[model samples]
Target: MSRPALEVADVFRSHGPAWRRAHAGHVSLDQLKVMSAIERCRTAALGGHVARCADCAYTSIAYNSCRNRHCPKCQGAAAKDWLADREADLLPVPHYHVVFTPPAAVADIAYQNKAVVYDLLFKVSAETILTIAADPRHLGARIGITSVLHTWGSAMTHHPHVHMIVPGGGISLDGSKWISCRPGFFLPVRVLSRLFRRLFLEKLMAAYAAGRLNFFGDHALLADTQAFATHLAPLRRSEWVVYSKRPFGGPEAVLAYLSRYTHRVAIANSRLIAVDEQGITFKWKDYRIEGHNRHKRMTLATDEFIRRFLIHVLPKGLHRIRHYGLFAKSACADNVARARELLTVAKPEGEPTSAAVDPNKPSCPCCGGRMIIIEVFARGATPRHQPTAPTNRIRIDTS
Candidate 1:
């Protein structure tokens, strides 16, 4: 993958401080922290180490990463490490991709009530899929679902949706056999859509009645029960969007898709085109349009672009990726184990290994040897001058 000329970090490093000053007290602390982390990521501001190739005597400086989940530059490694652990969980079966998006009217309400609405989204959508799939009329099995929450559209607009990767078949209710759905078909999207719409609206109204939801700005009038009911009237009648893409070729395809979307931020660094006096320009897809016409560029004032990005910073400690039904964390491992056994496939050797590694460690560019830190330096401090000595360890400095 060739590096893009512009990156999300570049945008923040240039205009972040100015935007912070202008919008002081208006942004969330988490959003401000995200801006600060992105601006300083992999820069001297965060401190770093010097790594040298032991064989050929090549040297390089590697700065520490911010590791913020919202940082575009940080998610790559996070995804890679996460996928390593998930690799063992892949059953030898086809996987389906389904997306459930709330209507624009409900999306507006969800913007203000993010915690409640987002939680409801995951709950209702997962329930809808599980409930409908277990019915004899549909797949007639308890399916596993790995759902990821995405809150932005191609243009960085606030569009909340759940992307689900489901196995093509599931365990029968009696746990006696593996039940597979018809090839090239998962479930009827219309059935899923109607169930999702009805369930989401029901729970949302219940939350409103319990006073667990808050309305602000233009939606403040919805604080009243009658007004809130009236506000949701249109949403109730509107068709919720639920569509499933073609089933992936195999388990490997599912892994590839997970690597891309599971840890993705609202906008990747590669999508950024330019930043200038006018604004920041980036490529965006108009999904409403078709083919080449859908690929277009968009520019927003730097502040507005930052605003749009911040809208996607999820609440603290919220889990964006979740598993439901058979894939539910409580039983996922057991379920995968059983599924593999039923399919007459043996678990791979050394299955379920944790592939976690130190994020700051660097490898030699020429020799590919692990670089060791032989010296310590504080932020902005220069390395000390020392007599050259024959040693295998790579001398390092924070500066």
Candidate 2:
């Protein structure tokens, strides 16, 4: 496939320095770092090395990647590596995709209190699902959940939601057998929605009472206790969005879904149509419009585009992807093994695992030879007669 003509890196490379200068003291250090990383990614600013094909002598200067989590240019390889690590963790059963979204009001408050509110979001959403599924009236089992938090909507708006991938079954409370949810269905959305609203609001009110949340800008008035309560009053009665899609066809489909959903940025390089002096033009989906008009193109001035993108940068070191219940990191391995054994399913033979990679070698495009590093170069240095065909290469080690 042909690479997209315009990329997020191009926009930043051309306009990022000016944006940083214009917003100097106003921008967060994290945001500024992201801009710098994107502007210099896969370029000489970060340094690189030269690789020569053994068979064809195809030599090239392969620049290093910024590997910044927030960079759109850097997530493709990360997603692939992540998927490979998770290959051994897949359960042989149906899986469901559940989404828990904060109402517009909560999202407004969450903007300023990202760390606190987002932490609560992960906690409450997972608790709600696990709690409901554990009830005798519901599925009555201990389910596994993998939730990924997304802070932006299709139009790059501040919409916060958690996307969870869950097995349609769980271990029995007695730890004797696997309990399967009915085929094609998971939990009831209405039940999940109601409980999610209560749990989130109750916890949020506690956070407010304890003074853990910070309110600023137009919401500054919320610093007052009474005002905060009044702000949450309407939301308490409103429905919080919680919905689940039909079960995935099989484990393979679940992997495919995770590959796209997890590690996704606000937008991809391929989605960008054009970048120029006027602004950026990219495809955006309008969920409210419905039908063919929903997928349409929109243009934003350079400044506004940068603002929208940075808003989703997230608090530094915050984990956007998380695991809980059976999938929780602490004991997921033992639990998964037990569940698989209960289902009388042995781990599939030769499950297409990723081989141990050699970081120093680059494969030859001409005759598929293992190309080795011939020389290393420092940051901002130019190589003499560097080959550029094949377009992409990875740099390993510095001389």
Candidate 3:
């Protein structure tokens, strides 16, 4: 794909220093590191390599990626690599997409206490599904889940939620037969919503009692036990948001959907229309509106844009994508094999399951011959030969 005219890296490189000075001590170390990495990504500051076509001798420079999970330029390759590994695990059964979201008031608390509350969001949501599915009243089988946490809405606001991909059925409790939900349906949304609300609030309060949550600035008053209880009182009666989409058309559709979401950053370069004296302009979907009118454009001052972008930089070492139940890393292989066996379906055949070509190796643009790396360049070093044309740029549409 061709390079985007503008990028987050460009915005960071131009205004990041001033933004850092203005924020001073308010920015977290993780956010600062993200800014630095995006600014240096695919630039001479991080070095690169020279690759030449064996037949035509055409040369190109391929800069090294920062490989930061939050970098827009780095996630396409990462998602592709990850999806390749997951392809073999997909079952022939239908797959469902379910979302779990907290109320705005709860989101406020989550913003203040991200680590503790986000962890709760993942655990409670998974537990809710597992508990409900295991009930004889529901599916009565142990289901597997792959959950991905998204912390931003289309406008880059703090809207924390978990998106789970679950096979339409699961292994029976006794591990003897495959249990599948009724065709065209997964589980009842109302039951899932009520249970999720109850469990999340219960655990959130417990986290507060254990002194694992923190409040600051406008929420400083929540530090008090009575104030916290009063704040949560209204949420107790309100319903939480838990909804499931219609099952995907097939396993191929599921793979296509997962590719788009697995490694997304706050915003993609394609969504960026312009960055000029008027501020940063970008496209966003106003979900409140329906039909064609939903797509809209908005602009924000450079400082505000940078601030909003950095709001999504996750805490260091927190895993955004997680697997639970049958998909759990420890028992995934065995469990999947058993599921295929019970279903009486053989593993996908014919084509090579692995990616046909390594993304790191590119075909020659001039002669369609293999490109071989001729030299390695260290960080801050320039390559011996500059490319006659721009090298392939990885593009991911995160919007």
Candidate 4:
């Protein structure tokens, strides 16, 4: 049997009692229920049934998933569906993934403004790329960008960053031919950093003045105007960190990269190293790159694990994925069509096949093939198994 995942429900179901006892006064009852739901997804607690294929007579045990945005089990189909939708819009050009991180000094202020700061991170980074790329000296075209907000570092710390996947080029404002950037480079990191810092700071200041920002107990110092201004002063002087990765190997690489990032919650289930009475143990990547085998296993107490996991839960109704420039919803289809026409790039054919992917898609776990959708029977319904019609009785041996 394959290794089982250390699910949110696992932590909640097995360890939730300890967490609730520890945080008796702080956690609401509804919060506990949400935790339980995420933990028990795809298990018997929530219930499941068997599904049969009409064409092939193959049956599968289909367990209902939580469908919570934070559930790792649900993200696979979400990512696949999302990628399917974006496939129609892929530009026939190279694409790059860029990341922007706030410095420690700024991150202190950012901790208090997770909602606001994270939103600014998306806007500033996407806007920074578009503004710079559209310059005459640069690519000078409007680019398509899809960005995701990530708030946790490898160690489950509050390190926030934005990951952007961008098609290598864009169309000029006048809707002329597709413009391509230098093969390896997308935009200058130094330039993007400076612009991003300025744009974000300006917007932060606006949010502060509008009183959309919040300051808690220790961070109340930021509530004062002078202190807030002083806090931003050093960031103004210091160089911001806006880093860009080199262009993807090819279009397939771009899809593979998206398959990994999009719809991914804080951690994948496979990363969990162990779960026992001591607590939950999991492997995490060390980005500092001290060595190739840098993944470390760490265990935590039940309460500590719950605290760490729930800490990353975002405020309700906030969007972590955003589109900008040519990728913006208002004009993406038109712009993508025009750009494709100008570049004379042929559309990729048929559905994409992931080497191995989400359980929901049900492609051959052996060699991947279209697990054709044959039927949809209702709940508690079963098809009558009929006697096989013999080929010998019906057929003449033409061969």
Which candidate comes out best when scored by lDDT?
3
Q: What is the Cα-based lDDT of residue 70 in candidate 2? A: 87
Q: What shift in Å separates residue 137 of candidate 1 from its native position after superposition?
A: 1.1
Writing each residue's lDDT as its tens digit, candidate 3 over 19-136 gives 9999999999999999999999988788888888899888877778899999999998999889988988999989999999999999999998888889999999999999999988
Compared with the true structure, all predictions reach lDDT values of: 0.85, 0.86, 0.90, 0.75
Q: Stretches of candidate 3 above 4 Å error?
A: 349-355, 389-399
* Per-residue alpha-carbon lDDT of candidate 2 for residues 151-214, written as tens digits (9 for 90 to 100): 9998798999999999998998999889999888899999999999999999999998888999
Report RMSD (Å) for each prediction in the order shown: 3.9, 3.1, 2.7, 7.2
* TM-score, prediction 3: 0.96
Quick one: RMSD of model 1? 3.9
The candidate with the higher TM-score, 1 or 4, is 1
- What does the lDDT come to for candidate 2? 0.86
* Model 2: residue 337 alpha-carbon error in angstroms: 0.2
Q: Give the poorly placed runs of model 1, Cα more than 4 Å off.
A: 1-3, 351-363, 367-370, 376-399
| Collision pairs in model 3 | none
Compute each candidate's TM-score over C-alphas: 0.92, 0.94, 0.96, 0.84
| Per-prediction backbone clash count | 0, 0, 0, 1
Clashing pairs in 1: none
Compute the lDDT of residue 63 as modeled in candidate 4.
Answer: 47
- lDDT per residue for candidate 4 within 198-219, as digits (tens), equals 8988998999999989888888
